[model samples]
Target: MVARGRVLVIEEVPSQETFALWDGVRAEGWDVTAAPLAATVDAVRRAAPDVVVLNLHGAGDADRRALYLQAAGRLALTRTPRRPPILLVGDAGPDEKPLGVADVIRGPYSARHVAQRIGSLSRLSTMQQEMMRRVETAGQYGVVPPELEPSNQFHEPKVLVVGAGIRYFAIERTLARRATLVGAFTVDTALDYLERQAFDCVVLNMRVQEAAEFTARLRRNVDHFALPVVVLADPREVDEVDAAYAAGADDVVFHSGESAIFAERVATVLKEHRLRESLKAAYARSRDRATNDALTGLFARGFLLDHLSRMVEAAAHGGRLSIVGFRIANIDEVNRQHGYAAGDHLIRQVGTVIGRLVRGEDLAARPGGGRFVIVLPDTHVDDAAGVAARLGAVLRATRFALPGASEPVSAEVVSAVADRIDGDDAESLVARVTL
Candidate 1:
């Protein structure tokens, strides 16, 4: 299997728990490497991990601070495309919020939870790097890039609390000063609130079974799949904690009445979520008519080829890259039967669906007519095939309304996927699938 990403763990004295964490993360499809604290800088520079986990469980306060500073300094000095976020594996004190520390996983927690955090941080790092490159590329086309600095204007995050009881009150009180809170006592009420308005995150304070069900339901919806979710559970109940992570909870907080710690954890997740949203928005703003297809609102054919050439060169240094081609097999027939206008409408609708289905980092382009292509960097052929199949299925299922026909028309979509091999140029890679 293709590795999800690389993870480097720094520990002065490795323990069984640390080894177990590596094993679990490796099983979760991440390539994990362990390095002594003394070699932290060298290991990080050599491995170039997507994220770093520093274990200071047995270190003194001074030692912990020094180790973190050392790691942060090395990361700052290293000239990488994106600096990996550091995850402190031990308690870093309530008020000791150090720079460069993405998050702190305190107290007793399962390896799965840590792995999930690593995955999120890794993806965030990749997205940030991609955004920078895309912005730079767009600048070449005379598209003005969005300002990189954080906006002075602040928007209070809106949070939905789904459940009642002491934990709900604790969450509400903790976020009262920092966010806008809306309480939903029942699952139905929460779902209704979600439909009515947008929320930055959702805190589930109900029973584990109910919360798990609710999280699964939210994951099924395309709009809410990436929404942050925090499941409140009793630390003593190990089963509940496992269930929460299994159901795709972003963070499972063990409720011990420590509202301060809870607040910090929630804040970490919220910050990451907001940063991701901002990057996506910035990239969208950088798109111009010169680089985007007129009807599809996707990258123009020329822009896609230029970007793919750069990606092909970068993939030379150990990485996976895949391209997917989508063809509306019966588009010509539809145009002849119903008018060219109806055919254009059908193509436009299909393009919209492709844009919505693809990830923010994936580049989708309409090379004219019913042919579209998507470039997925850091994605293996199997995963790219899965994405292609899903897009094809959705397109096939969609019914299109024609101008004169009483019955809606259906589509026949043909999809092909190809991975970059040893000696492949952008044109050659795209041709393998599109041709």
Candidate 2:
């Protein structure tokens, strides 16, 4: 894969021996360098590497989280002359808490897996900005790019002009040249359908309906959403232009000019909106990257807490809840004996087997570390324990192939399970595993 810059390694023990072993990566034409763990940001600044590999030293969960954020923040805020993606290597120690973030590789990670992750992150950076925009919009607005114009066509300007007045008819004719008339509204009726569908712009003519009611609904919409609007009013009520704008009208037109000008104003607003969408999309992407781990496609730490908290509340009123936290021991040894890629394969295998073992209503999530927690609703303590034992047995039974290793590697699991007792909440339930 192609990268924009070199990769810098920051770890507790970036010994000459470690560097020698990783020379295969250097052989692949990657400029790999090592620096002291505390000098992560400094190394990043000097090397300006595409990826940052961390050699953790058995830090606790809190420390691991803080470190992950520290590195992630450095990557995000320190705008360089040239920015490269940050890839973290978390294979430094056994029982070390990892953020489950930034290309995390626990102990025993495969060298090939590490190389592939670095390569893939670089390739992902080459994703086209236009394609990014399209993707960003798809999640929020169900729209196709070419269909934007055709979709905006609401009604026939000619047919709409048949009733209003001679001056209005002239205005409609002018508008007909530049814009496709969407649904037209006279005095009594305003748009009731906009609430249901996505619209880039809305056109409301107050000539037929009372301006106050129509404006009221428009104002309600303004309170509810952000959509560009053009209000058509009687020339006599031009004094209401201030109110129209206040009520969220982008442009207000009367018999003062033709419909052509009205259409032009609407088009301008839509163009501005496209820019707003881009900014919003980029902001959202950065925010998502902040807490989310891209590899497993799991919810971020904050999201998981908010979600599980809500689940706990629901479980309080609805029924009992059980939760289990599990960790795989000896996997780190496997990675060191074999390679990180094999370790990653085992993690995925564990995740899959545990996912399949749970009930449909239950939730299984990794909260920022290698630690996996499963929440089972309406489950008793005994059942929760049984599930945990079954999961442990699965880990014990499953055999995995390793890279550059003599024998197959499997997991040794230590798990804790608990159920709601009395009015116990999420934090307390989770603490039960500790008890």
Q: Show model 1 residue runs off by greater than 4 Å.
A: 58-65, 78-82, 148-153, 207-212, 219-222, 234-249, 320-337, 379-402, 405-421, 431-435
lDDT per residue for candidate 2 within 1-435, as digits (tens), equals 222236676665455645654675665446678776567666777775656666554224657646654766666666674355665555433223234233444323234334544544443332222234333433333323232222223543221221244555555565656544445435332353444544556556545244444544544432223455655666666445556544444455454453443454455455444444443343334334433334343334454455456557645553356788877777677677667777776677666565545433355566633567777654556556766775666567667665676676677778998766667766666656532
Report the alpha-carbon TM-score of model 1 versus the true structure: 0.84
Model 2 RMSD in Å is: 26.5
Candidate 1: Cα lDDT at 65: 54
**Each model's Cα RMSD:** 3.5, 26.5
Q: Enumerate residue pairs that collide in model 1.
A: none
Count of backbone clashes for each model?
0, 21
